[model samples]
Target: MASSLGKLSGRRVCSVALGSGLPRSRTLGPAGGRICLSALGGTGSAQIRGLGSGSGTGGVGAGGGARRAPWLVAGLAAGLAGVAAAAFHHLAPAEMVPRTEVASSVPDKADDLALRCSSFMTQPVTALSELRARPGDMKTQMELLIMETQSQVCQALAQLDRGATFAVDRWERKEGGGGISCVLQDGHIFEKAGVSVSVVHGVLSEEAEKQMRSRGKKFKTKNGQLPFCAMGVSSVIHPKNPHVPTIHFNYRYFEIEEADGTRQWWFGGGCDLTPTYLNKEDAVHFHQTLKDACDQHDPGFYPKFKKWCDDYFFIKHRGERRGIGGIFFDDLDSPSKEDIFRFVQSCARAFIPSYIPLVKKHCNDPFTPQEKHWQQLRRGRYVEFNLLYDRGTKFGLFTPGSRIESILMSMPLTARWEYMHAPSENSREAEILEVLSHPKDWVH
Candidate 1:
């Protein structure tokens, strides 16, 4: 557990730290921001001082900041309680586990089923701390939900493919958090597949805070490293059959301690499809499923997130879309935390329905060497997008104690780049390129 906590601390939490240095506590004397760190179990009476306000969009510098007062105790207590609850939930027998001790207490049957699915899987302690602290904690709940979704999606895919199962890797960071990385290589249907779930916490150094400010993050801090917590699930699937398209999904929650000891949090994630061949029906099904999920939560969500997806995944250098867009959203902390968490859950659950059927539809289809070559070429472009422009990749590379293998697990098992290669005019590949060049609405 200690090892996992350390790994989780650095995963996503420290990635945003573009670090400057931690301020010594003395510099944060009573003159700085005043915070009360005495909310949990009446630890003591004292005023804590630190620098920085905790308001930011949350993609960068999301979890680094100081908490100087009693509120600090509240946040820490919540986190510790969450972790304890998670440990108990995992170690205790089901009949012995009290309902009140559960991380979330939603009344919906659907939510219950989702929780059951999650209960069967293991979660890092840090991930549980958020839940114990606040039953409705959006960040922790989303992480749990996403982790379950990853398990279910990968399991379903494995069942369909036959004789393919993901090998799980559990790793930890010395500072404060850990994660599980699941990968399937040279499978019956997929060439490579990676699904990862991480929970991390860490402090952002002064330099990191300044860098975040430059990037438009809104926060103020006095001295000492800012504290942060991040959790999420990320995955990419590459099929063996060229006819089958590639898919990617990422869902995450982030939180940071404010100078006032208040916690600032947000949710971000999306799913997109990349096909070697464009099938109008497949594209329609994928987009429609995502739309349905969003509609169930907010009718406006689909359109907004759809546009964000198109804009975010674009390969600016090549002037092409990464794939037919699905839905992407970030910095979301509105319409109530519970609602947004449910919304994220809906999106996470939508993945299998949106993608698996397509895989089943095309997995056995015959493909010639020429088509396979095209697929590899397309994969090369996928690599380009990830290594160059993907924010998650950049952050992972920068994060402390990052496992390079897991970070690069999204890379294709095999990809080929050709100099000045172009598909034949009016051909199937060319048609796909045209659509990518100008993303179209598969569902409106």
Candidate 2:
């Protein structure tokens, strides 16, 4: 049950090919005319006329001398095509065909498969229109990928507990994208568990953009508006048995289009464990599983993210750590977007292996009434931290049209706040509090 899983098993597979088709010639044509790169061979010229008049030289010039770089030519061709399309849309809007209609000409099976995979875009024309506006959009694609993973994770978890199955609810945001929320309540192994996937897009107003600038996002707006896309999978599991421990996992991608039409994006997420009763071996195993995933990408990742999680989840008002830290990171635009995405996928896949074995080991362990009460008290702290300090919760609340149910899904099914809740000194409960006060390097 190692959490750092490789490929997902079984028939369901979700894989992304970041840079598969490149350095290939493509015809950028409108309804009547075609601009063929092949026609622009050595010393040759093609009348690239469509929405507007333009003349382009060949990649190779006279005497077979090198003219423009192949990549540059390709880029110019793409730019020309985009400009032409926009001009055509502006001039003769009805003449411009929707890409979906063009795609409909393909074979039935291929078309069917394409539509089936994008079934999430069905209904709510407002949301679908936003998606259609950007074909093969990275944010939308990532949203679908994470939703598929969420389904797979829930399916796998439900298998472990025969009575546990997520109640799926698909929703659309009027402003932009949509999402799926899966919740399992009063299950055999878990008390309350929620797995939510959302892909939301909207125009950030000048005020919102200013707030973001204040928060240190390095981007300027165009025309007092900024387009933003956010996609993520968030989960929280509150187990029935206190010994089994509670867990949380979240992975997300955020992108904003700047004034120059360049996209600024980043990936952020992490997973952590919260055990009401501190079990040394379980804590070690959990951290080691996540550490293995981090190490696979970079030796420095585990330490950095570990410390980040420790700090981020700290309850400043209460002067305590929420739980034993696992890993957390934000604003990670380093390396390459592809590499960062791959790393996030690795962390998502690692969830089951890291927590399942621990659940299986302790799910049925006996607990006293006092211990159960202790668990409830611990849950109260979780509620406090999320309401007052969790960045995710704050953002969700601010986001227009965010589903309240999914936003508050992290709350435990039951929790209590005693007048003076203090465990006896030298007791196991007291030991947990001690560890919470002083976060430990479980892996080391």
Candidate 3:
């Protein structure tokens, strides 16, 4: 029931590793090349003309990598090396989609929206390609972005761990091509980092998919295709200090069903800061950056969604919310699909600037084993939210033919639920509890 789960129970696993679609080394390679999923260049935002849950017959295709595969290690190194090499060679990054309305063509608003969504998905793949870290032609660009961004985040933390530098395991792709997954162990920057992505496809008629989807859940397409091609990316980064606190963020793209099964797509993603120990300035800075990104799209969005995030993320089991309030909402159907795509794009475009500085600022902080323990305990609550309440996890599992590995990529390498344990009196950790016990609106 824990959404943050282990490899789908037993039997044939979907993916052994989570993150990056790098080719398996010769020794690791199988009798033949890996199975193929789709030729679509990037994460395709197929317009879902409908949304409905169906009782269709089809199972998720299980693919390569063991959670302990050497390829992910190879890919992470290869990805980082590739990014460095690409930048050194002065390679130009991917072209961003035109956002200003004046610049966009009025002749076709629908197509314009599609173009913008595609551009948003393409840039991450470009970044991964520059890192030389993506899985080759055998894998889709969607798989590549999932893994490459993961390595980028993890490597940032590894740099801060002067001692106990965590070893990054191989990145893995889900069966039937949902997305990639990655995790690190014994890390010094907090404890571990886990990330994942989901890319689904259904080939029903645009009208059929839309009609069914309007019912509120996914409707299965005939022949194992999904009516809605939902792509999601989520990550959890835990710093090694009780003083630093942990953070969770997710970026996603959802398609509206087309009448004949063609997808009508829009993008969505946001980052939030969660500290075990509250630093008002750190919280303010985090929220302000998010506010800036939302402001780029609409002045009304930040306030509404910020309140939405706070309400949505509340953890009922814990009697407290995960972190201070941040932006969150679901089924964000905008009047002009193009406008929604731009909003989601803004969130993706905001990640590097918003989070990298925080990681750089705290990666090198000094902390003790006691602080590390507190971080792990907080992760337990993080795990609870994902498993018990995460709609994404339920969708990944309940959806006919959902990928197993990608669904549970948020699980940490190690976690603990201490028996009636408490941190030292008046310690940096207790200060964190005082904050978590009482949630506040950081942005306002």
- Local distance difference test, each candidate: 0.63, 0.62, 0.48
What TM-score would each prediction reach against the true structure? 0.72, 0.71, 0.60
The candidate that achieves the highest lDDT relative to the unseen native structure? 1
Residue-wise lDDT of candidate 3 within 202-319, one digit each (tens)? Answer: 4433443444466475543445455444555677665544555466677665564544666555444556667766678878777888889889888888888886776666689677
lDDT by residue for model 2 (1-444), tens: 001010011111010001112223334346544343244331222221111011222111121222221111111211111111122332111111122421121235744334534322112212434445665666655655675567566765565554333444444566676555555555556667767676667876455465567768988678777898777878888877777888999888889998999999888889989899899999999999999998889999999999899998899988898999899988899888878887888898889899989888876676767777788899999999888887777566555664555566787878999887788999999898899899988876
**Superposition error at 443 for model 3 (Å):** 3.8
Q: Best candidate per TM-score, number?
A: 1
Provide the lowest-lDDT 10-residue window in model 3.
Answer: 45-54
- Residue 144 miss distance in model 3 (angstroms): 10
The best-first sequence of candidates by TM-score reads 1, 2, 3
Off by over 4 Å in 3: 1-176, 182-190, 203-226, 256-267, 422-430
Clashes of each: 42, 3, 60
Clashing pairs in 2: 3-350, 3-353, 3-354
Tell me the lDDT of model 1 at 255.
82
Global CA lDDT of candidate 3, please? 0.48
TM-score of 1: 0.72
